[model samples]
Target: MSEGGSVKRSRCFPAALLAVTALGAFNAAAQEPPLIRFGRGFAAEEQVWLMSARPELTPNQGKKYQLKQILFQANPERFQAFLAGELDGGTAPGLAVIFARAQGVDMKIVASVCLEAAGREWFSTTYMVKDDGPVRSAKDLKGGTVGVVGIKTATDLWARAGLLNASVVPDKDAKIFPMGFPGMGDAVRTGKINAGTFVEPFYSAEMARGGLRKLFTAVEAVGYDHELLDIWFGEKFLKAHPDTVRAFLADYVAVTKYYLANTAQAKRDLHKAGFVRTPLEIYLKNADWKRDPAARVDVASLDKLSKFMLEKLQWLEKPVDVRQMVDESYLPRQ
Candidate 1:
């Protein structure tokens, strides 16, 4: 990617032209690092947020590889970007991973960003309904509307799975409407929608304002622990820049380690980076997303969910061999 240090020009070239061309090429090469175009969604996905916030922890950044992060409001569009060849890789939900595989995209899971384990104390996606609303659980949602980030997204999948488990058909028993996370609280509160998915900063803010009750978490809806979101790479990109990818992932894990160890400071850095805008005290009091310090992916959880989507949810056309799609070589050594 660096063009191997220097260029070799033929002896026939004029001295002045050769020097100018060589110098210009060298300077251009030096100025341009391999751009890692990736997409990121909001809140507690420290891999993207932390890496940019704490550049010192990522030694290879700007030298070996540069980042061109494209932000998305939700996960489905991010996956569309990856499949459309717009991003090298970034955080994506396990459902998106399987969906990509089903669509014949050759991408590999490189590392873990976060998990939605059932019993994990870390922050997970919470579906909220009015505390005194008529609907109480998945079973009570018949003829009601459910708001999510998008159809077939992780939130939508969980919402549908929860409904199915309760013997309520998704589209027939309850409707799903897509909207941005920022407005979910108001939608549920004003009775614009019966229930909706709420992730971080918004979740806490909405709860503090009162009038919402937790219907079920992502884990509870899906009925097990699973890889919620993970870092991934296109197969061709991984093959072309294995060292660059490895270095980026190494820094990625380092940021995770640094964040877990120094959360308050990390949050302060995030505040400074403009990722969060709350008063320092409020941001610090918010729960952090559950990230594995070692950058380990729950491939088994992915596999189980893959099977569930294929067999139970009828979301996938064929079985996805999640184990085969995983490539942990990019991660820092244990």
Candidate 2:
């Protein structure tokens, strides 16, 4: 009888352990918050905010949403991922989104990511050349090649516009060569390209390398305050999870405010993220962290960009309805 009782107790112990394991899993599942995958660009400012803000904004009982940031090397990749449903939402250039919509990709601009504010130079793409290189101005780039991260991207368009502002006809006088952002500084440094367009970390990195100077920034080329990047969401994601989207925007706004307020912490986060190689002060001085907490999408600015893409660049076949493409309802309520 003692031997039978010992075997029975061992079997009961195994069953009890299994019951506990299953119950723990069930409780965890119940507590897991809804996740929204966000595709972000490879900019230092954005990365800093993403690193610092995600923790503060998560697990809100009132919001009920969690954010998962997905990094993309370029806007095209991010846009493609959003189209394929790999990303719930992400940022894309206003022109890129407009062009994608013209091709039937159903997406909406939920908020502004980066913008050029009047009397203040927010983060803008910069065109750079060797400090002592022969090219002194955009006109000097005539008959030579300029490296751009991608064709028809904001960087590319901005470079072209800079050249045009200097009375140099792009593609006619100066040519654009596609190169990765990581390689652009080297390309210009080694004389592989006459000039290269760089954004944030790359711009800061190249500047820190001690042999480059800015020919012009996007703000100078555009001649007015414009929205450089915008937060967007696919139609399917919006339809399935509107509340989650709203919650995310609310959290995102709070995160942006936190980043703007605590720039020193943001620089440390950027360094930790492997975006900055130089001292924290180098990044702090070079990068501009000026995002509004409201995340407002500037319709007039977007419309102007659309018009520029359609008329000046001839990249878009026609103008897109900037108002229709923007959905302001998802922005965080004040």
Candidate 3:
């Protein structure tokens, strides 16, 4: 299990354009109605539950906000929309925050929303192959094939990072094929791939199949690090309604604490958000969320992780200033 993980998005950056378009809709909607429309995507389940549940976790007050749309696009597109002023606010990957700022996108990370505190790192289930198949570890497969999701996803970054950690260069030493998570075990079992990266529910599913073996998870390979998912707002929104931003932060923090303290409610929300299929207990068995008292960007840790990704995985076009993208003033001070 490899764990881990944009700009001018088109299909390459639809999320960017979408963000701008989304924002215009919000503005128009605001003028005509009391509704506050939100363009969001699924990340951590808590966000949907807290923001919509009783006592609303968002800072929008009694204005009434609706999750207008949920797009599954990656970070770059989402931030692109924010920069274009189409989206009022949305969550994005940590790296996207830096990339958007570097490009002068006019957005800032206002609060840390979700944390992958405890979960499977990058581990694998064992798949049987013909005797000619290569052995486990990069050292054995100088020219073997492995399965990964998309090249730009966290899974890919972690896979490449894991390779670097193992002293084997991916794409140079081994070939990585793009495939969905569901196909990983099948690919390995049928010898379509040497190994595949699987996480959580998938991890437990593969394990139960009795063919896969654990390789190494993100924690085991990358250390006890955290994966941060955050809420980023357009600069325009902050300038126009700074108190609204502060209120949002307070509600966000309160909801996070509420969710952690009352997991059943959180799980119910997760189920609604479609992160888990079965009971909340099944999903919780794989992943748990963590909240920082102050959910500001962990600048130093992000820098280290970003540098590793850029140097090893060539994920970014240029280096970024983590501090500039992170504006913690909106979060309430203890």
Which model, 1 or 2, shows the larger lDDT?
Answer: 1
Model number with the top TM-score: 1
For candidate 3, write residues 1-334 as lDDT tens digits.
Answer: 1232123232446777789999999988776423233446543546544566444455455543334434654665665665555678777666556556656777777777655453443222222222345565546655777677666555666666666677777888877788877778778778788768775566666666666665555544455454456777777777876876776667667777777677777777767766557545566655554556466556666676677666766767787777777788988887
**Each candidate's TM vs. the true structure?**
0.89, 0.84, 0.74
lDDT of 1 by residue, 108-177 (tens): 8999988886554577789999999998777888899999988878888888877887898988778999
Tell me the number of clashing residue pairs for each predicted model.
0, 0, 27
Task: Give per-residue CA lDDT, model 2, range 1-334, as digits (tens).
Answer: 9999999999999999999999999998887767778888766446324533446543452347666778787887887787677888887778788888878888999988777554445666778889998999888998989998788887788888888888889989988999998899889989999998887666777776789998887778888777777889888888888888887777677767766777677667767766556666776677573576687877897788788888988888866888999998987777
Ranked by lDDT, the better of candidates 2 and 3 is 2
For candidate 2, what's the RMSD?
3.8
Model 3, residue 100: distance off in Å is: 3.3
Candidate 3 or 1, higher lDDT: 1
Whole-model Cα lDDT of every candidate shown, in order: 0.84, 0.78, 0.62
Q: Pick the candidate with the highest lDDT.
A: 1
